[model samples]
Target: MTSDRVPVVVAARRTPIATKGARLAHVTAEHLAAPVIRACVDDARAATGARADIGDVVLGNCMGPGGNIARLAALAAGIDVAVPGMTVDRQCGSGLSAIITAGEAIRAGDDRLQLAGGVESASTAPTRTFAGIAYFRAPFAPSGFPDPEMGPAAQALALRYDIDRHQQDNYAARSHQLAYDAHRLGRFDEEIVAIGDVRVDDGPRAGIPAMLGRFAPLFAPADGELNGTVTAGNSCRISDGAAAVAMVPAGSRGTTPGLALVAAATVGCDPALPGIGPVAAITRALADAGVTLADVAAFEIVEAFAAQTLAVLHLLGLAPDGVADPRVCAQGGALALGHPWGASGAVSVVRLFSRLVRGNAPAGTLGIATAAVGGGMGVAALFKVVR
Candidate 1:
C-alpha cells in the first residue's frame, strides 16, 4: 500500500468494560458493539460536516452466535444498509487485526471511509459442541503441536522467564491503581460510550495491592518446588465490551488530530509459548516502521496476565522495574479494565487514541498497539500522531 493513502483514525470510542456476569451480563455482542460503532461514525461525521460514505464495517468477535456479528452490529448502529460487513477471528488478536485490515483497504485507495473494531460478550456467548460433545475451546493447532490453555501458558512463561509471584502481584496492583486513578480524574470520559447505567469501567479497584496475598496460584508446577504463580488477581477478567474507530484516508482528515497508520506486522511463534509472540511481532513492526523501542512514547500492550505481560516486557527490555512502567499502559490495562477477548486489542488502540491524540501530543509522536494471540501469534501496529 502507498503511504499517500495512509488511513487516519478520525474517531475512536469504546463501551465501558464490564466484567462477565456483571452489569453487562445480559447484553449481547451486537448490542455491546453497536453503540460504540455509532458513536465513532457520528464523531467522524460531526468533524467532516457530512454523512460518511461508509465502505464497510469490520469487526472482530470470538465465541458469539454463529451469524455475522459485524453485519448485525452495523445494521443495529444505523449505518446505511448498502454498506457491507465482515467478521474476522484471530483469537485475542482479532480486534487489532480488523483495524489493520480496514487500514489496508484505505491504503489501497478506497476513498470511502471504514468502521472497524471488535466486540465480545463472554457472559452471553453461546455454548459450543461438536459431534454431540461439548468443548471449551476449539483447537489452536493440529494434534501434533502443543496447544496449552492460556493460564498454563502464562504459568510456563512466568517460570521460564523467572517472573516470581511477588512481581506478578505488584504489577497487577499497579495496573488496578493506575486505572482507578485515571477514572477518578475522568481521563477515560471522552472515549467511553455509556450503555444503560454502565458509564464507567467496572473492573478497576483501588485496594488490590493490600489484598495481594489472598489469591492462590491457579497453575502450579508439578514438582511443587516452585508453586504456580499465575492467579486470578494477576490475570484478566473475562468481560463484555466493544471498541471501534472510524478510518479515512489522509486527505480526508479535515484538520482533525488522529493516529495515522504507519506500519503493522503479524508474526507466529511456538504455540506452547504464545505469550512470547509479541516480542517477535513488536520487533518486526518497529523495524518495518523505521523506529526503535526507544522511539515509542506510548505502548498499549494487552494485559492478559501479569506474568505474560511482564514476560513480554522483560523480553522487550522495557520493564526493568517489573512492577510498573509509566510508558506502558500508563492508565492501566486489561488486568484492571477487564479483557473482552476479541475487543481487548481494539481497546488498546482506543487507549492509544486517548493518550496521544485526545491529549494533544505534538505531531509525529509515536505509539503502538499490540496483542499476543492464542495459537502462537502476535499482531502489532505502529501509529504516529498527525494533525
Candidate 2:
C-alpha cells in the first residue's frame, strides 16, 4: 500500500516438485532452492537489461535442516557474499509470509532487489526427537488445546462443512487432470527451473478420475466411527521443491509484465479446525485491495487437501466445484502438482505469475495467492498485473 516504491515481482521460478522419497530424495533443501534462485535472478536481469545486485534473500522452511537455509541457499546460488539472508517458519504459509515480509521491506524504503520464496526437502528432512521419544511434527497448539493431526483436522473441516467424499474426489480428479493437461501443453515451461536431472513435476498422473474412487479414507470420525472422507487420493503428496521470485521497487521494473504487490494479510484461527484459516485471510486481503472475488482473474490457493480447499472456497462464496471455475487454478494446483509444505505458498505465487503475467493477461489483471497453514493460520497476497 505504499504510495511510492511499491513492490513488484519481476521474475518467478521453481524447481520441479517431486514426491517425497521419490525423484528428489537425495537433494537437500538448500540445494533444491539454489537453482530456482539463480534462475529467477537471471530472468529479472534479462527482463530489465541490468545485472541484479540482490540485497537480501528471505526463504521459508518447515522440516528441513535447522540452520539458516536461506543463507546457505543464497550462497549456493552464487549470490554476492555480503548479501544477508533470513529464514521464516509459518508452517505451510511460510513461503508467502517471506514474500510479504520482503514487500514490507521494499515499502520501508529498501530499494535494493530482493529474492524471497520457500523450500522444502521432505525427502531429506531429518527425523526429530524430544527427550528419548521420536516425534513426527511439532505441536500446532500447546497443551490443553485441541490440535488434531492435519489429516484428522481436514476430515473435521469437511464434515463440519458437509463436503462429501464425492466432492473431494471430483476436486482431486480435476486437479490432476488440469495439471496433466497443462504440463502436456507446456503451460509450465517458463516457470520451471530444472534441478539436476529433474525437469518436470512427478505428481500429476493421467486417469486420476478413474482411480479416485478406489482410495480409502485416512482418518476416523471424532466419535471413533468409520468412513472419514479425507482420503489419500484427495490430499496432496508430501513433496520436495523450491520456488523463488525476484522482486524490486515498481520504479525499477522497466517494461516487464509482472505482478505488483497490492495487498497481503495473515490471520489465525482455531487450531482444531485449522483448514478454515484461509477464509478470514483472503477476505481481509481482498478488502484491503478494494476488490472482490469477482475482480480477481486468477487464484492460486495451495491445495494441501481437497477438503480444506473446498471449505475455503465454500466459505468464500465461490462454487466448490473445481472444473466449473477455470479461474481458481487455470493450469493446476498443489493437489496435482504436489505440496512441498513450506514451499507451496511461494509456488502459489509462481503459479499466479504464470497464469496472469506470462499467460498474456491484460494489465491490471488481478490474482490472489493464498494458503492455509498447519497451525491455525492463513496467508494471502493480492496482486495486480503491471505491464
Candidate 3:
C-alpha cells in the first residue's frame, strides 16, 4: 500500500446555517441535509468543470431514529441509485471521522470521488434518552465506558485547567468579537449559503456582555464551593444546521483545485475530562504533519465551551488569549454560530477551506479543525491550501 499522503482534494463545500429570522426557523429536518449536499456537489462541479460522479456518500449524524439518512440525502440530491451511501455516528467527531474514512478509501484505491460530511437539525433531532433501567445497568455493571455528559465534562475541564469563570467569559466575548468582525468583513460569505434569503448570522450579537455580574455556575454545588465555572455565556448554544464537503482525488483536472486534506488524527482522553480530547488529538496531528502549532496559518477549534477552548490552548502552550492568525474562524465559532452537533465540525472545515481559497493565503498554509466528543474523544484534521 502506498504510504504517501493521499492527495485528497476538497472539491467543494457548503453550509446552510440559520443566520436570520427566528433561530432555526428557516430549515426543515428532512430537507436540511439534502440542500447542503446538493450545494456542495454543485460547487464542486462548477469549480472543477468535471462531471465526476460521486462513488460514495458518507454522512455523519448523531440523531434520528431508523431513517437511512445518508441514502435519503443522496437521493434527494438527485444522485444515481447506483451510488452507495452510509451513515456513521462518532459523537462530535462524526463529521471529521467521515472525512477520514472517505480519504482513506480514496487512498486505498477503492473510490475516487466521495461525498463526506455531517448534518444535524438540533431543533428536530431528539435528545439523548436512556431506555429501561436494565439497559443502563447492563453497561455500567460490567464496567463499560460511561458517556460523560457534556455539561459535567466541561465543568470538570474548567476545574482541572483552572480556567476561571471570568476568563471563560472573556474568551466567549472574543469569539463574538471575532465572529462579528468576520461577518462585517464578509469573511463568511463564501461558505455560508443564505437559507431562504437570510444574509448575516443573527445569533452573534454586537456587544459581548462583560462577566462582572454575578451569575449562577452551570454545574457547581449549591453551597458555592467555587466549583461552578462553566456558564451559558461561555458555552455553545444548541443550533440547527447542516454542512457538506465534496472530496476528490488530488491532481484531478480542474480550474480551481480545492483545498487538500494533508493529515488527520483522533485521540481518546479520560472520560472524566472529555473536553480535553482535542488537546491530545491536536498534538498528535501536528506531530504527524511535522508542523508546530506556530506553522498553522488558521485554526477552527469547535467552541463547545469557552473553557474547553481555553484549556486546549493552555495545554498546547498557545497564546492563552487566542491565536492571532487572521483566518482563525474570522466568522466566529460554535459559540456565536451555534453548535449543531454533527454539523459543527464539518462546518468548521468548510469555513477553513473558504478562507484558504478566498483570502489566497500563503502556499502550504495549514488549517486545523478540531472537535471534542461526549466521551473524551476528539478528532483533528489538517488541510493544506491548494489552489
- TM-scores, each model vs. reference: 0.98, 0.98, 0.89
**Worst 10-residue stretch by lDDT in candidate 1?**
219-228
Q: Candidate 1: which pairs clash?
A: none
List the global CA lDDT of all models.
0.92, 0.90, 0.73
Clashing pairs in 2: none
In the order shown, the candidates' Cα RMSDs to the true structure are 1.1, 1.3, 3.4
Candidate 2 residue lDDT tens string, 135-187: 87898889999888888998888888888898989889889888999999998
Candidate 3 structure quality by residue, lDDT tens digits, 188-286 = 777765556665566576665554235566797323575688777788877777777888776563446566777789998877678888888888999
Q: Kindly provide the TM-score of model 3 when superposed on the true structure, using C-alpha atoms.
A: 0.89
Regions more than 4 Å wrong, model 3: 1-7, 19-28, 127-146, 197-199, 210-215, 221-227, 253-255, 321-328
Evaluate model 1: give its TM-score.
0.98
Q: Which model, 1 or 3, shows the larger TM-score? A: 1
Task: Please write out the lDDT profile of model 1 over residues 312-362, one tens digit for every residue.
Answer: 999999879675557999999999999999998899999999999999999
Q: Which ranges of candidate 1 are over 4 A from the true structure? A: 222-226
- Global local distance difference test of model 1: 0.92
